[model samples]
Target: MDEDDVSVLVASLLRGDRRALARLITLVENRPRLRDRIMSLIYPYTGNAYVIGITGSPGSGKSTLVDKLTGELRTRGKTVGIIAIDPTSPFTGGAILGDRIRMLSKSTDEGVFIRSMSTRGSLGGLSRAAYDAIALLDAFGKDFVIVETVGTGQAEVDIVDAAYTSIVVVTPDMGDEIQAIKAGILEIADIFVVNKADLENVEATVMALQMMLDLSDKGDWRPPIIKTVATKGVGIKELLDAIERHRAYICETDRIEKMHYKRSKVRILEIVRSKLMDKLIRELENSGELDRIVKCVVEKKMDPYSAADEILRKLDKK
Candidate 1:
């Protein structure tokens, strides 16, 4: 699409056209030359949606929780958008798309928009286009935007950096799993959900989480641990209440503004990082410097650090 097409697309997206919004998201995900232009056009329309991030170890029932939470949000007459980041297949570079299948219940609802994105092998757990998709959903007038991460093993805390309120979901069955997860991931939680509450060891898991929270250095706001059987929808109301409580607390204390500033800074840094890496790779490939550096390193003619320095010097010349 040309600049004129982008203009019309932006206009339609702002006017709440789902088709237009989907097209814009595709453009942003592909990092088209006019991507910044699309974002600039819609940025002002954002900052309206309340973004919630849900992350946890795999098999924690996070997707089910998100589906329940979306239903709960809809009961309050709120429009919701869900971005479920699934692990990408290395060979195919495509996601299983299971989240979409699980959330087929919402497919017929006009007020609900569900999009499943591949992690694209990002260790951070979120798709690189996640924030861009969130912005598009917000600008399209979603009342609440939920981002669910791939949540393999280490539990990427990057979701915390992007979300206004981050929820960490943990299940009771994973033996010694809580202790195995990174401390940084634990500290990022604003609310914790011990899902599968009906399962054995639920109390043990809850107590462990409570002890952890008690030991945390959260100044005024202590993260709440809510027990949930997401599949059966038990404890969902209380979970939703806890989420709202945190949202209210942040707003009351004016912490939301601080979070907004922090998230904006992160977004800017990510964009700069991506652009710089892309430019450097393109230049190196064009100059044949990348192949030469790899060959030298493989042949032990030059150390990786020295070759990296050489590449930096070449970049500086450009």
Candidate 2:
């Protein structure tokens, strides 16, 4: 699409056009060249929506929790946007399981918009375009945007940077409370959710988490632990209430501003790094320097680091 088309689509998105919103997200994801313009248009309308990030181990029931939360949010007269990060498809490099399939109930609900994104080999359990997708959802006038990360266990901590409220879900049957501490998941949680509370050894799991929280210096706002059976819609209301309390606490104490500022800094640096690498690689490839360096590395004539430095030196000269 051209500049005029992008502007029109963004206008429609601001006016609550769901199709327009989906198209804009697609454009940003598949066509990286257009991402900056799209985000620049969408940024001003954001900050009105509350963003929540949910992440955990593979079988922690995060998707179910997110679905229940969306329903609860809707009953209270709120519009919801869901960004579910699924594993990348090997064939198409796109999301294999669509949001409609996972969230069949909310598919027809006009108040809720669900979009499943492929990880596309991006680490930290998020799609590379996830931040931009959140902005689009916010600009589309959603009151709440929930980002459910790909279940990559320990390395999923990046969600903290993308969300005002980050929830780390854990199951009782997962075993070994020490694993949580080791994973560094404890550090990022604004709320700790012990889902599947119906399972045995639930108390032990809860106790372990409580003990860990007591030991850690969590600053002024201590993260609360809420137990839930997400599949049966149990304890979901309490979870939502905890989320609200955290939100109010951050807003009243003016910590939300600091969080937003930190997120903005990380995002700007990420964009700059990615763009520079892309441009430098393109330049090297066109000039055959990249091929020469790879050949030398493969033949063990030069180390990878030295080859990389040589490339940078050449670029600096240009």
Top candidate on TM-score is 2
| Model 2, C-alpha of 305: deviation from truth (Å) | 1.4
* lDDT against the true structure, each candidate: 0.83, 0.84
Give the per-residue lDDT digits (tens) of candidate 1, residues 1-318.
877899899999888899998888889888558788888888888889998999988668888888899889999899999888766677644435754456547767899988877767454546557778999999999999998875764435778766788999888997687878738656788998999999999999888888887777888889989999998989999998999999899899768788878867877887788789889999889989899899999999999999999988976787
Per-residue lDDT over 1-318 for candidate 2, one digit per residue giving the tens place of the 0 to 100 score: 887899999999988889999999999998886877888888889889999999887668888899999999999999999988776558744434653245537878999998887677564446568888998998899999998875565336777778889999988997884464534877889999999999998899888888888888889889999999998999999999999999999899769888888878988888787888899999889999899999999999999999988988986887
TM-score of 1: 0.93
Clashes of each: 0, 0
Q: lDDT: which candidate is best?
A: 2
Off by over 4 Å in 1: 91-95, 121-125, 153-155
